[model samples]
Target chain A: MLNNKEYLNKLYQSDKPLIIYKTDKGYDIYTDFSRRIIINKKNLKYFLNIQTKSKKSKIEELNCYVGFFGYKLLCENIGIKFPKQRSKNFHSGVFYKPQTKISIGKKIIIKSIKPDFRNISINTKKYLQLNKKFNLNLSLKQYSKIFNDFSKNIKQGKTYQIKIAQTYSKKGNINSIDLFWKLMKMNESPESFLIREKDYNIVSCSPETLILKKDKTIRTKPIAGTLRKTKQLNKNKALTFFRRNEKETKEHNMIVDMERNDLSKICKTGSVKIDKLKKVEEYRDLFHYVTTIKGVIKNKMSNHDIISSLMPGGSVIGCPKISTIQLLNRKEKFDRNIYTGSFGIIHSNGDMRFNIMIRTLLNFKNDIELSVASGVILGSTAKKEYNENYIKAKSLLDLFN
Target chain B: MIYLIDHEDSFTYNLAHLLDSIEPTFVSNYYEIDQIKLEKSSTIVLSPGPGEPKDYPLTTKIYNKYKGKKKILGICLGFQQIVFCEGAKIVQQKNILHGYQSHIKVTNDKSIFKKNFNFLGGRYHSLKMAEPFVSQSMIITMRCVKTNVAMAVEDDINKVYGLQFHPDSFLTPHGKYLIKKILSR
Candidate 1:
């Protein structure tokens, strides 16, 4: 394990953002102004003094990373195909394309990132020590923005989820906001993140993959049923209705069927397995019907092929893939550049990880854009969709005005 | 120009309806720094969305980039974001609060000169902080109607500010004033 804090200190000390990223169950790479280090699932390879492209920013850049949990896969499967490797070069690994140069405007001095430490665990002691480096004081009032939008979108029938997440823990005392943002940017992983500390800014500027790798380990947690809080309400009945509601059950079944068929694409015949179905998990605001699908990839399938097969997750696109995508095409009035897309990175080794940029922000030069959308089903009402968008817009709306 | 952070059809249309007088621009959340050249025209707003601050770093970057150069307003996460961007901590709450009439108490009138705190109510369901804290330069302008948690905070911190409550929300009263007060500045 590397002292990520010390590494972060080094990046900060030099005022350069380092790019650190990893492939699932494989290798992790860290590129920066000083060095470009690659850490495989086993050995660590150092590639210093690498080549750079003619175009580059003269300023320093830093980015770092900590492994993301598998729960991340559920978010990306929103409107794309399920259980797919996001990056094209995962199997072959190692993508060193046109790099950026930090020049003084005269002689072009090329620079390449270095490779370092290989073995790292989600629960490593050294990782934990390094994780404490950048402790942020996070405000708690944003969830209401989610609720407000949820109410509005629900009324409009734009079906989407309101997920409130917190950094329960940081594995590597890695505290570089710039580094974390940059690492996910590498490979421009669609599900990767870049949140700035100075402005509490965040960006899903990933152009790579958005879901988990291998396409074998697949997941689908379709949401259904919601509880409207009222002064006069029956708790037990509400619980019973939520637990076994009819309408909710139908929505749940539709998604389950939708997911099963998707799994059949990458899985062997009869290999699709249901780990859990209709599991109701209660959150601060509402409840959701979560189902888990597990399957092994067919022996002769390439990750990219599987990726093309499942470009947009079904969660965002709706049940019947074609019809649902078409419905969204007609109903959705906004251009979803990367909001519903994905972003993540592929390392030298084949290990990969990614997420859905649902709660993503588009940062252009003069404009700071925040985007969010939801799935609209056949049973969805216009009011419901509107409320869902409202719920969805809670955080960004709060941040904007 | 009414600068909104969200790109919903009505977010533009309805905003246009509310101010049927102005042609507001509903911006999208996907751009590099050079794309968001939001230099002084009038109002700039950071909109709402899913995910936490860590997900959309660019919005914050853009805000800080134009902090002193423009008159800005943050709604929902945009609200919390401005405070956090100016150096406050954004932590998740235990119990999420949402819906209309979720207004807070305005302890001070630093940015906007408002009187009644009860009239400041807006529709919302969020997880907020206990102490309404801000950077030394910022002043806590308003709070939750009931909890009194910091609902709005601003200060001499580079003419930039934020509101935890929703002003564009159809539910809020005098949202037009709230938006204009910041934009007009």
Candidate 2:
């Protein structure tokens, strides 16, 4: 059998923390997993990531991804179900839609990560250890076996995902998720995830993504206001409080409008509709304003188009899109790179799913860079804005030092 | 007790510590602010945080109730909120300027900056106050150095005061002195 295992193993080598990945650069392939790295006998390939839409001619030639996307395609084509499945939007990066393909037999998946790649001036006093070294002597075969068994359990609903994510830090070492939990304790509805590309290097534990998706349809919910509920009040009072609350609604409505415009490019014009607005949702640790926007795809837009339009979700970007990006770009020194990019799965049929890249960490070889920020409105109190970001930052802070 | 009645704990805590008050607390999370009874407090301090004033209902209620009831002081966002409610205009900053190092001229020494003067305060701010309220008949104890960008206006007419600089911060040499004026009022 012309197996892709050998090629995948080639990409999952030891030594380097990250690898360059772009499976079929000529053709864009759908991949829910963001564990991408193109490894050869000697070198890792370069993949160009673009925020702008590619010309139709350019996109038509691209078909498959270099790393996990290709692995996912091969698995689906071969019907090899993963032995264990724990894919989350937080760490999976950004998947345009959701699709599953698993073979009964074993398969190979290649991944590369450069955990401690770039480092400038980090808040070393506040170090973040973000790596976990799995020293298990399990080979590709054994790992595959475990995955197979895990997939069987998932089929039984033994393992289900309530929240999904991928996170990073400056230091390549993390003691526990306790710090992440601490942030959650401060009223942060944390979304957690784990990933190391091929085998091992760095793993991510994230707490956010304003949206979740299912097939060609999608949803974008921006978190604006927060109120940790202690007791349930009467329905009418609760409704009145949520509706009457001035600050929360403005924060939410702006995001909804922003999301609607985002969905407009890939989704049908009128198809994009706010299914629900300003519904107070209570997750494990935090209560938030979760609004659902749903729309059917209009143009025969590819998954790339959808992801392109919604790269950094609106909740992170703020109200005015271009201005916010430019404003932050001017102030913030470090490059965002993949730090804010999302991860998820792309169905073979073209549907995909992904989440916002909040509560993230970027590991530095000798140190770590974990950061969190809150959106600032015109009348925002300087102290309040700082505290909001600080609360969001707590998830990763308590983890390292 | 002094409640930094806004979020952004790091910044507020830093300012609160500088004030060196008997009791200082951070209250940006509305839930925390709501649960705590404000009846026993001697002074109410509204710290800074994200979002414009019109959105914060709690702050509005607090503003309406306080109405300079207790010795009140507002910083950055708090300043704008209290001033606007007390009837004043807040103009949008045409260009955002965020960083430290002051470019303002404090001409008045009566209101908040009573004693110390002729100084530069470290500041990182994005917004500005336009045409602040200052009493015409009586001495309002306020000054505007827009030619220098930093302006402080006192509606002594309404017993309300606003600080363009973080007076409760050590970044400004006379910051503590300015805050003392409000606290001891």
Candidate 3:
């Protein structure tokens, strides 16, 4: 019997489409897929409908598809169309029907159509480190200009809050598994995940859960306020700061309301309520103000309705998701790719869990890119928000150092 | 039936769900005003949205067309539309309060809000109806206890009501109650 690390290495060397999703307890590794569903603009609705109509498998956990939905795909899903921006033209999203499944929690469990481990040897050294410097796509001057424009929009009541994205890119060969491990050591977020595909790889330490559905119950945790962690600042002090600061409280409130509104679209009336309000989540570099909202899913609501209402989550975009997205699409030069997209699993039983893809590194064709953004409200200053973006990207960028 | 004119706002669905709980509601974008059967609806609800009321001239037209015929209710930007149509200037608020909870004091007991009782409401707007309200028909019903900014207004004769704060928000505990009260009236 192989150990967990050895099993992961074997799967990684297989060069098959794979995903290692981190749950609250442990990791769920999916490999040896039978089919790959490449989602596009035309087939999105069809794909969603099919997934919704899938029959429950005899085995519960093994019957699932693990994949990601890109930012452009989610935007289009919600009926927001924009002119094509300069991008690497990554596939909108891809999902896999896995034949082999491994769950590494208190007990290691493996379920596969054919379990064959012969002729595969694990390397003593699991990963190689790389030293590459990342450069921001937008300079301070450019970001400031965009920030001022967004501020003007906020003042005009065009949007209450908007997130301005900035990308840090570097051309280099990256061992995604190696980088994922290193970043996890530094910042092990709850919604973290790693995907290794033939064409591309995604490593994320995303902290926000856009949607988590089980049967008729659905929940979302919207993270809004961010405070840089210091020697003197702890979770309690950070909570106090978030409570006293009018701007932070207000920003968090807007995100909570927006998320609740999204849930309200598919949730039964009077069932949408805040489970936990204004809680503090501590991370390596920052402390976030988060709120957990739960709702009872309305009868006959399909997976498409839930995904459309929640993807490109409001906490990452802004309040008034539609208008804010339009403003962002107009102002932003590059396609967001999968930055604010969602990554998770959809089970045959209609149970699903997805996380907003923030604090993620996209290593597509050896052009590694890490995108980060900060929420800019009326009281937000350019320099502060600009620096906040760097603080977000610092953990991922430090892996290259 | 309640006719909800969506302003491309995120909270429109929330308000729709709230209104639907009280009465069956039909929602349409403000641009699709011509397509909707406005006469079929007993109440016309203008949803909270981005931008000032001037950006939605069609909503104002609906208010003008159905002022006395049907009950008109507006929230956030919708509230500004009612004030804007009533000959009041919508200016930038001194303190922009988005998603901030404030205690509102009812100034007019004859309106939907109970008099002398303060209640928390969620505010999300950058613009406010300019002070010393010049409209004779529109009466300011509720004002923020701290800022004293106009939080709610109503026209009894025209059966039109507007609320600056979002009653659909969870922050506003009495959100459903307020909606039910307005719809019943």
Candidate 4:
């Protein structure tokens, strides 16, 4: 029997970041770092060649690795040259190999042998108190203008769609682990993750999958449209309204089509198919219209090619991805850092899964930063889109309340 | 009765709303047409959707079933399919129109939709009719004033109508009336 409580206490104080990814039915905890892979200008080649090394290290019984890829990796993977965009508070991307991998499910599986657990119950009442007031880098008016500009671009056919994002920040010294555990208990999602890196801790309750590679198949669940959950709103009415909403449907369909195009590049010819379209997923305080696209990995295509083909997740960037990303870089106030970036493990068996970081809170020393974005198309209104940003961030912020 | 073939387009829900009087039964492109009871419905609607019309072979099959039997109105991509099925061609436009409003003039007012008045229409399409008319028998009902592109077409004999513009979208003024005209026929 492993000492789960003792390990949690050690993880709460560990200097190295830990990754906690909840699988479909259970939790997979990655910690006790051993190897490091930093994606930078110098080691870009080695970083892209990670799949071969991972495959070589594969053991049939136990396989686990965890880290994050920043949004900037998209530019590098796609071979688009860009000037070094300044990172505001966090490192863009890095991967870490954990010495110990723990899987808690029907049967507890602990990789790497070392284990400890103290039979102590944590007081659930002890919670982290955070400032409710948030500081926005871009004013509401400025955000509206940016949204309008993107809409104009859509009208002119410069780009079909662009996602507008803004960062909400608050300064405080809070317990990151407590906040994460509170969120884990309060909100349940398919891709809920808690990532702790050197100075920054990422606590995300994301519901979208950037990419999931299982054997020869690659799948992604892109979540585009959103509806705020409310007690007064009838579930049926909301579902019907979401289905019929023109802007919401258009935004979602555009992402789905774009994702299909992205996957087709690395996937075998005629293997890409939309498994699901605009299915509404209900969360604690938000409703997301999700779509699943699946494709068979081409035998000749390396993992590098697959990641390059679909990085930064199409839905987060927008349709006509390249130009839209350039436009976003210019319009948004700060770099995305690890938000909208993905974090997961590449198993030794050539399997991996990464989640899109929405509804996430990141701690950078003195500041707690949270970002939310929405797709802006031709008919998008600034006021409604502004409200949507808040709606997407509400679940994460509610943990503070 | 209205049989709405949902191509997973955002406009399908709105099109369904416009035809609420008929209580349109919605079926996706994935659904097999042979299994559906299309004979019970008097009208068939092909909902607007993304991608090339030829990509959805199911839609072309659905169009064949209701060709001359049921009164059909094809919207956007559906409109492209009706033209393609009728031996016409659809090509990608140099510039795609998405969520744009345009003024359309009624070219052939003598047809069933006898409104000589110019009206606003909503457009969301990347593919346009390469040839304006499907065949010599088809009438060019409405054309955009700015681009001179065919916005609406009809074949009285086959009872198949096509609208390149979205008349069900709220952006298009008096869209419900157009839906009424198509259904009443």
DockQ for each model: 0.01, 0.01, 0.81, 0.04
The stretch of ten residues in a row with the least summed lDDT in candidate 1 chain A is A41-50
Contacts from the true interface found in each model, as a fraction, amount to 0.00, 0.00, 0.84, 0.01
lDDT of each: 0.43, 0.44, 0.86, 0.72
**Candidate 2 per-residue lDDT over residues B51-100, each given as its tens digit:** 44565677778868866565556676677677667556556555332223
Lowest lDDT 10-mer window, candidate 3 chain A? A122-131
Please give the distance, in angstroms, between residue A328's alpha carbon in candidate 2 and its true position after superposition.
1.5
Question: What TM-score did chain B of candidate 3 earn?
Answer: 0.96
Identify the runs in model 4 with alpha carbons over 4 angstroms from their true place: A1-16, A50-52, A55-64, A81-86, A113-132, A232-235, B1-185
Candidate 2 matches the true fold with a TM-score of: 0.41
True contacts kept of 4: 0.01
TM-score for chain A as predicted in candidate 4: 0.89
Q: What TM value does the first chain of each candidate achieve?
A: 0.51, 0.54, 0.94, 0.89
TM-score (0 to 1) of chain B, per candidate?
A: 0.79, 0.76, 0.96, 0.91
Better of 2 and 4 by DockQ: 4
lDDT of 4 by residue, B1-185 (tens): 67778764434645654665445454444355635457688788887765667778987887887688888889887888888888878876655566557898888865677667689987777678886454766777888899988888898888888999887654576787877877777
Which pairs clash in the backbone of model 3? none
Task: Kindly report the docking quality category of candidate 4.
Answer: incorrect
Ranking by DockQ: 3, 4, 2, 1
Tens-digit lDDT string for candidate 4 (A31-79)? 6666667766456556555532454234343345577777776566665
